[model samples]
Target: MGTWSARPFGNDSAADWAYELDEASDWGVVSDALRVAAEAVPSDLDSDDAVTAIAAAEVVARGLGRVPESAGSVDAFVARVSAPPPEMVALAVSALAVAASAEGELADLWEGDPEWLAENEKLRSALTTE
Candidate 1:
């Protein structure tokens, strides 16, 4: 099996991504991430993001397909989209976990991070229902 890093997409730090240069510095990927953040998407007809964070997840998953193997790099994708769905946030988490699991990185990220791991676990559990 291949060795993977313990990095949840949003868990990425500064050095994890410095390739974009222009957007990588100012936006720092976080802003781009917010583009698909659960709290960022609009839920209502007026494009209201105040409804639920899950809304962002919906869009994220729809557009990004599945979370890539590196959650750290999601910001790169998020930066491009001006507005993403609410469920995208959840999509981000699920896809990132799938990516991690495939790459063997999930074990590392879940280690010692009970809260984060717990959230991931919950997301994993929810998959069965979906």
Candidate 2:
């Protein structure tokens, strides 16, 4: 991924018919946007679908640099990300938390997640399958 800068969002995150993401000035709006955007998406960060949400939040947060470390070091990464504009941080955290919630996987499964996002786990395995 190219850094998660303040650069405009891509087709992956904001669809052609979706509402304008930046126009969201509060939680209700943000939640609405994410709901519309992630409607069919089965999972988060572990899923490209989820990463798309994280990236959308990053566009608003302007903390794209954290992408490199989000996986390797979550605490340091969240701390750095927590320092951004409040609206940005809150939105980012909300989106990420929702992403995590959607999948129900706190960390790597290292195996199948039969109860949570089995589809996401399947996709993840497919991504690195040998």
Candidate 3:
């Protein structure tokens, strides 16, 4: 179907980690990624790191909804998005879209899983359009 790249999202390094989460279907890993990212957030959260953190948090949020494990990261992401300029919001949303657009061999683990796919797409659309 379609190809996706994480370069546009900033911190391509984390993209593979994100894909690994989807590929492995491990919720524990989700908690870990988000926790690590959240712990790193400071008052001076860089736009690049913020984008990466938001993208990862979006994936966890999509998978678990309002999970306690991801609460801090999700909260951080929400705060960052809310306070940023329109362009920053757009950038964050675009990163989420890129993550949602994941496909091919890397995303095969999530393919045919309608619920998971829909959740990702729903979050992606909400960020991009709202």
Which predicted model would earn the best TM-score?
3
Models 1 onward score TM values of: 0.28, 0.30, 0.39
Shift in Å, residue 39, candidate 3: 25
lDDT of 1: 0.35
lDDT of candidate 3 over 7-75, digit per residue (tens): 222345455445554344334444444444344424333334444445555544333333232324334
Q: Compute the lDDT of residue 90 as modeled in candidate 3.
A: 45
After superposition, candidate 1 runs with Cα above 4 Å error: 1-15, 18-81, 85-94, 100-103, 119-130
**Which residues of candidate 2, in runs, are more than 4 Å off?**
1-48, 63-85, 102-130
Residue-wise lDDT of candidate 2 within 59-110, one digit each (tens)? 3333324323222222233343333345544554555555545443332431
Q: Which tens-of-lDDT digit does each residue in 29-127 have in candidate 1?
A: 432433433222122111111111222232244334443332333455455555444443444554434332423333343454666555445444443
Predictions in order: lDDT: 0.35, 0.38, 0.42
Per-residue lDDT of 78 in model 3? 38
Q: After superposition, how far is residue 127 of candidate 1 from its true place, in Å?
A: 12
Error of 1 at 20 (Å): 2.8
Q: Please report the candidate that would top lDDT against the real structure.
A: 3
